[model samples]
Target: MSQFNLTINQKKYDVDVDPQMPLLWVIRDIIGLTGTKYGCGIAQCGACTIHFDGKAMRSCVLPISNVGDAKITTIEGLSDDGSHPTQVAWKEMDVPQCGYCQAGQIMAAVDLINKKPNPSDEDIHRGMTNVCRCGTYNRIKSAIKLAAEGGKS
Candidate 1:
């Protein structure tokens, strides 16, 4: 087992694990950060998405060794008070059904907004792609738009 220094969720961890092990396993199994869900072990699904130094990436396929000194943020660490405009907008607009993919979706959306605050519907549609079994696309789009518009805050 190799040791990797991971800065995650505002904490530093020296994890002793297989170097090739995915960051998802490190987060879920080793560190026990359950908010980053595992969907497809491959990179096809967005459920495993998280922020790597403010950029959204699929944790399921990212190796522990690849993390290096990058700051990793999950759904739990996105905002301290859960009042990030996106989070508030999500709740206000009621954007989840099964809620399985919302975390990744939110993480990605936050990245989008960080890069471009007032994204158009096409931009929103292109930027966020979290698959919901309940087909919450309309609500998700609305929440993202509302969040972009400040979530009624």
Candidate 2:
């Protein structure tokens, strides 16, 4: 086991684990942060999405050794009270259905908006590849739009 120092949600964590262990397990099991879910174990699914130094990353396939000193941000770190624009828009648009994928969705949405402050529908469609089993794509789109507009809608 190797020691890793991770800075998540502005908090520092020192953990001793296998270098090949996926960040998803470290976050959920070791660190006890369950907001980032485990989906397809592989990186294809976005359920394990998190912010890796302000960019969206799939945690399930990312080994702890690959994390290095980059700052990580999970859903729990996005906002203390769920006041983030994307989060607010999510609630206003009632985006989630099963809600299993919402955290990853929101994280991806935040990254999208950060890159394109006013993202076009095409941009959203292209940027948000996160899978939603409940088929809430329309609502997710609406929420993204609202968030792009600073949650005005």
Candidate 3:
């Protein structure tokens, strides 16, 4: 077991784990942050998405050793009271159905908005590849637009 120091949501965590362990398990099992879900163990599913130094990353396939000193932001760390623009827009747009993938969706949305600021529909379509089983794509798109608009909608 190797020791890793992770900066998550502005908090610091020191954990001793296998170097090859995926960050998903370390965050969910070791650190007890369940907001980042485990959907497909592979990186294809966005359920394990998190902000790795402000970029959206799939934690399920990211080994702890690869994390290094990057800043990690999970859904729980996005905002203390769920007041982030994306979160607010998500609530306003009523974006989740089964809600299993919402956290990753929100994280991805935040990254999209941060990168594009005012993303076009095409940009959104291209950027958000996260799978949603409940077919909430329309709502998710609308919420992304609202968030890009600074939660005006």
Q: lDDT of each model, Cα atoms only?
A: 0.88, 0.94, 0.94
Error of 2 at 26 (Å): 0.4
List ranges where model 1 is wrong by over 4 Å.
Answer: 151-153
Model 2 residue 59 lDDT score: 98
Return the candidate ranking by TM-score, descending: 2, 3, 1
Tens digits of per-residue lDDT, candidate 1, 52-146, equal 99899999999998888999999989778888888999999898888999998898888888877888989988888767778898998888888
> Global CA lDDT of candidate 3, please?
0.94
List model 2 lDDT by residue over 52-88, tens digit each: 9999999999999999999999999988999988999
The CA root-mean-square deviation of candidate 3, after full C-alpha superposition on the true structure, stands at: 1.6
Better of 1 and 3 by lDDT: 3
Candidate 3's TM-score reads 0.97
lDDT score at residue 37, model 1, on the 0-100 scale:
93
